[model samples]
Target: MQGQHIPTDAQKDEAALWHVKRAGGSMSVAQEGEFDAWINADPGNRLAYDQMRVLWAQVEEPARRMSTAMAGEKPRFDKVRQWFSPGRAFAGVAGAVAVGACVFFFNPDMVENIRADIVTENETVTDVTLTDGSIVHLAANSAIATDFADGRRDVELLRGQAFFEVTHRNGDRFRVHAGPAMIEVVGTRFNVDYLSRNTEIAVEEGAVRVSSNDNPQGVLLGAGDRVAVSTAASLGDVEKTDPTAIHGWMQGRLSVRNVTVGDLVARLDNFASGRLVALGDVSERTISGSFPTTDVVGSLETVAAAVGAKVIRTSPWLTVIY
Candidate 1:
């Protein structure tokens, strides 16, 4: 065999795109390590990927428009050709073409710009161990991106929820971020939910402080304390909650108390791959129970009975209660 030279930057770009093509779905923990190693092999790989992420974010809106326009008319991709100009400015022909391929081929449902250590799909509850020996139990449809560097441990909750059990160290802060808010602690067990159209933090042990962009003053939360921060606005006062009852989803149980029908449906639909649509006048009904997350449809039936509504299943993909 002849001797081979080091790969040029363009060659690394091609290889990085190859990895990106196969990414974004569920993979085993070991596979995630291999993938991370490949991405970290060269600075060129990361630089190329940064360009792709920018292109991906730019394509999202255009993709949405194209999908809406194609719903009634014959399928057409020609109109999108002119839109490639934005991507051209960020990358070369190869990179621009990669963006086009993803825009037309991959899942539009996955809008998360995934550059992370590990990812879990909808309806899954999996656990991950970070470099510093901390454990995170990830909830359904959630994504976590972690960076443990120097004297700090930083993590981002891209979407959905996660319960972090941190291991303490002197002079270092373990921080979990959701939206614009940060939950900092020396060591503790806590859950963060980003799926409720806001950020919710509930602590089961130790204590943590939460601060947001708009409300930088934030609040201190002790064990059994919970709080909510509306996106970028103010955070509500801390409230007390039962940790075992609230975090029972780890045991396949969905527990709640005095929540409205709409709120219940939203929680159920998180575990369901299908749509759970509620008809009129069902939003105000208060619900309290322990329903199994493994059987969301069954739980929906229980909700229907409690709220005096009928369960209607048109297909496995759609369920309606009214």
Candidate 2:
């Protein structure tokens, strides 16, 4: 009988890097090709990557419990001895945040600004009127590059989200490119958010045509219509939305329904300095709430309370919820 092939330590490390790189969602064309080549290089390489993925998935629950205990929260059992004060506990967790923040806080915006025509910092929103008279309400931590040429208007969302009140001009088309999706309108008010790996589109007035890389035929969305396109370029079902609520972020508000703690943290992270990380199973729990984006610490506490979790603000730049 032949012995089973085992992936070498180098292969394991390379596989881990590949997983992180892909999760970062900033892979270049050349990097993607290199990734494909590496995956096809050997069967052992695939096995190692698969192992890494499984290991990552399995750690979530344990991470939650450990983080909760580390924050000086009351454990499930009274018998368990408490080892640290709340301040010291948060300091320990903050130390971990400091390490992870290096990756999470990696200045992607700096790179984004290289090609961005307009950029907004955290906690700030900007309004820009394009040469064609189209108005864009760019959200915080967002960047956009505009091109008004060839008798057409085009805007690419480099990062974050934006609301467009497009101006009509002799049937010339206005297009907004976000992730795998393209939104085209003649004259309309609409919102596009590409903060996550996916792109979400919502129309406020008039109509717009939305298409994705996979769905080139596209779909026409009227006012109050909302949809999302996944990272794989797959279109989601169109849903009805309230036009007034479509751009709530503009008012420093975020409305969520049955949203996971992890996802909520990610959105709130955009409005404040530093980062908010949900550790352990608490991150997976779901809750519904309307949070004030301007009051990130208060909002985090409210979210944690709703989910029966605890919030630990180790510093201005780091908050851990578990």
Candidate 3:
């Protein structure tokens, strides 16, 4: 039997149609005909359209209200709009006030001057070269804020992981801000993985200064060293290890050392080709192995066999363990 090919095109069309219909614009006869033809082209398209249509109906009012606000119009207090509008939901003036708050919170100079790469929820691995010839490899669910117009080059990693290969330049320092911890470097190659709870830094060459955003207490890390910062405790810890083993994900390898099963499953879900689930008492169990990010199922099976656990392939992209 042939394996199923995921309907990416159909899903994309469904999403596009949802946005079009939500904007409250009528499609031309030719356009509608073309849309119908496209939908009927495949059974999966119809199914995807149906699902998106349901979701469109649920958020139609809010979407319209947001559009109206963006257009700078006095929003109507229709019964449907009232339930979805930000004003009624959060006091009478909260919505407008929140917009002002956002403006104040975001630095005007930074917002206007900086050229930022904004990655949406679904986009994975956005790569960009900075003005100073530095290459930034942004991971999935990540964003980088930087300004190239200024004489100096600075980037703030809002969330997720990024690999930086900075070019050597005189009087230019490349800086990365991950949560409260800041990393400063010059002409270096390194990786920074900053999730919600943990901040990790591995230096491949040159050197980096890892410091807290709130204070001056930090440590300078050399090549082949790693540091982790815990946000919950606001403390930093350093360890000397093989940088390639920890930072191999940039090269398509998922390396883990004494990592818990729960953590492994979470990490695999981000970059793996399959959905990995841990069953039974595997949450507390630890795993120490290296695997390729391409073959998640094979890697999971190998790990499971090594640990004497059962590997159940629920589907092509879904796996359950026991």
Candidate 4:
């Protein structure tokens, strides 16, 4: 560590603010002068700024490729441009591409809108009554497709979360598919969340037979039971939970007992206009709160405070948490 410069928290925050302002658009004459002076003031300052810019580009690389691929264009970067200088056209293009990603890639509801039988936007919930009189409470930014045929009542949750109040039928089996996990129930009220790496199920009434790729035989979950199945279809712990809290989003509140900061942020991202990128491994920190689904930014700030972290708005389309 002798010849290296480590940026302090203050330095990092200043660099992040400067990057956001510069990426916002062209800077005013005086603002540009101030930025140049601040960045040139110390070797560590320049290092911090460059690090911020590089982090932005790295996180955006996937989104850029996704956008260009959809447009039938190749993904390329300006190799000669300095990462710290936000005035580069490359930065502007990347930001614009990120905006497109927010609309198309990150927002799965939009990508799957055509194929989904039911979809909900952010900060909104919708109730749909199926052919068999079963009711579904679709959460914000969620999508689902249904098929009822041959004595089979199937619902595929393409993305996000949903609560089902299934009605009983004499010879029909009601089943829900989320990622690699499958849940079957005759008549029950349950919640299923299709997360980034797992599909979670919480039973509020009656019982459900849950199976995943790892556990093909499946496990039976009754009232007040909750379980998470990994993307690989492996089962997680079957724990006790409050039935009311299981589908709390339907009431416009998110209640958690001991959720990790990362998981909380992931839920908040569904409501955010852009993205919430956690800078470090903040998973060890956990928080318990009942956040308002309508005020996502406020809930995010509360979560950050509980985890002893900072929230930096790096751009209109990106927020970095540390």
Model 1 Cα lDDT, one tens digit per residue, 255-275: 777777766776676777655
TM-score of each: 0.64, 0.68, 0.56, 0.71
- Please report how far candidate 2 places residue 178 from its true position, in Å: 0.7
TM accuracy, model 4: 0.71
Rank order (by TM-score, best first): 4, 2, 1, 3
Q: After superposition, how far is residue 191 of candidate 4 from its true place, in Å?
A: 0.7
Once fitted onto the true fold, the runs of candidate 4 whose alpha carbons sit more than 4 angstroms away are 1-111
In angstroms, the error of model 4 at 309 is 0.7
Candidate 4 at residue 220, lDDT? 94
Q: Which stretches of candidate 1 lie over 4 Å from their true place?
A: 1-109
Q: Write the per-residue lDDT of candidate 2 for residues 1-322, one digit (tens) a residue.
A: 1126467655665665565456546478998999999988987788877766675455334444344223311112111112112332122222222323223223335566789998787787789999998899988888899887777699999878899999999998899999899999999999998876468899999999999879998999999999989999999889898787899999999876666887788788788665676655677789887899889999999998888987765433346776
lDDT of 3 at 7: 47
Model 2, which residues run further than 4 Å from truth? Answer: 1-106
lDDT of 3 by residue, 184-303 (tens): 887888888864346888888989988885555678989988887768535456788786675676666767777776567656655643335554455457888787656667777777
Q: Model 3 Cα displacement at 54 (Å)?
A: 19
* Greater-lDDT candidate between 2 and 3: 2
Ten consecutive residues with minimal summed lDDT in candidate 2?
72-81
| Pairs that clash in candidate 3 | none
Relative to the true structure, candidate 3 reaches a TM of 0.56
